[model samples]
Target: MLQKADQVPAVVAEFIGLELDDAAMARVIEYCSRDYMSSHPHQFDDHVLRQKRESVWQLPPDGTASKAIRFSAKLSLSPALRARLDEVWADTVQKRLGFESYAAFRRSLPNSLGVTRVD
Candidate 1:
């Protein structure tokens, strides 16, 4: 990628949010692409996972540490479910396999929809 960085450096630099040269961009891509952790949608980062989990469900107690242990709490199965809900389920299952719990999954979801239930 470095050898051909001129082709997509801007997009990569923007996404990674670092002013990178071709060599740096190439290195970043290689680092992110080779690992299953980096390959995950949330990139398997703890802060993001915690935030997402909270968004999907209830917040952690006020005193909980930033690295609060993740746990899935029951959510009322709201009838106002969104389309392609199984995709959400699939994402959760995949996330739990190596990333986070159900609550964390909901928390990771975008916007207030994270707190909403599909099933």
Candidate 2:
């Protein structure tokens, strides 16, 4: 999807059998962009998930609450954990998604959209 971000609006429109005008298509594309979605995490129910986590954990609302979803350049993963994750991704996603490896999939995206390089 990230590979053809510009076509997403038209694809979605066709899937839903709706013919969106240029302006509406533009709006849909803008709203679906990574920048817009990351900026407006509430639209993805991040706030609700945070609230639920806080309630379950008895965390103070005014305290330093960790985000339910985060977009950042920082990544801290131990070598063992990273290896495990790679293995899991290979077993579950790589073949299904037609990627040789997670690294290859990450490289295929524009601007490394959701990826945080370890080094």
Candidate 3:
């Protein structure tokens, strides 16, 4: 599974007006936050796994130690959903990833989006 921090840095960088780079990418992998205690309303007594910090849905298909894409069959995000994505997911990603600025990281996304922002 890909780190949520990995997904977040780029999005947050876009928020605060910054650009993503290799160094930022490295940081996302390096300084990801341990957990989201604040977001969870229910408490659990069971042991929490904090290895690479990924959702169960993101786990590798064959249980191998590799990143694999997870698919959502009913994926349909509206504008409000996208906005919420920016607020909830992106904010956490930027913070946990330890980037100096979220905006910069976001600026790097368009290049990968086939928009040709990089020149």
Candidate 4:
């Protein structure tokens, strides 16, 4: 979806069998964009998840509680963990996705930004 964000409005309109006007189509595209979605993470109800976690798990809210929405591009896995993920991806998703490896799949994406090393 991030790779072909410009086509999202058309795809959604087609799926819903609705003919959107120019203004509506533009609005849909904007609303579906990564930048818009990231800036408006509250729409995903992270607060509700935090509340549930607090009540059910008896966990105290931390600094990260207010920042639950995370983009994968900003995350980094340890080398061992990444290798394990690649192995899993190759076994499960590589054939279906037509990608040789997980790294190759990530490279194929447009503007991956950059991964932040947690180590």
Compare the candidates by TM-score and give the number of the best one.
4
Judged by whole-model lDDT over C-alpha atoms, candidate 2 comes out at: 0.71
Write the residue-wise lDDT of candidate 2 on 1-119 in tens digits. Answer: 55667776776678789998889889988887777766875675556767888899998765433332445466789999989988988888886897877677867766423335432
Q: Please give each candidate's TM-score.
A: 0.24, 0.47, 0.24, 0.50
In model 2, which residue pairs have backbone atoms overlapping below 3 Å? none
TM-score of the candidate numbered 4? Answer: 0.50
What's the distance in Å from true for residue 10, model 2?
A: 1.0
Q: Give the alpha carbon lDDT tens digit for every residue of 15-91 in model 3.
A: 78987688876666445433332233123222244234345547543332322223325567899987887787557
Best by lDDT: 2
Off by over 4 Å in 2: 60-119
Clashes of each: 10, 0, 13, 0
Which stretches of model 4 miss by more than 4 angstroms? 63-119
Query: What is the lDDT of every predicted structure here?
Result: 0.51, 0.71, 0.50, 0.70
Judged by TM-score relative to the true structure, which candidate is superior, 2 or 4? 4
Ten-residue segment with the worst summed lDDT in candidate 1? 61-70
What lDDT score is found at residue 38 in candidate 2?
65
Q: After superposition, how far is residue 52 of candidate 4 from its true place, in Å?
A: 2.2
RMSD of each: 15.9, 6.5, 15.2, 6.9
Which pairs of residues collide in model 4? none
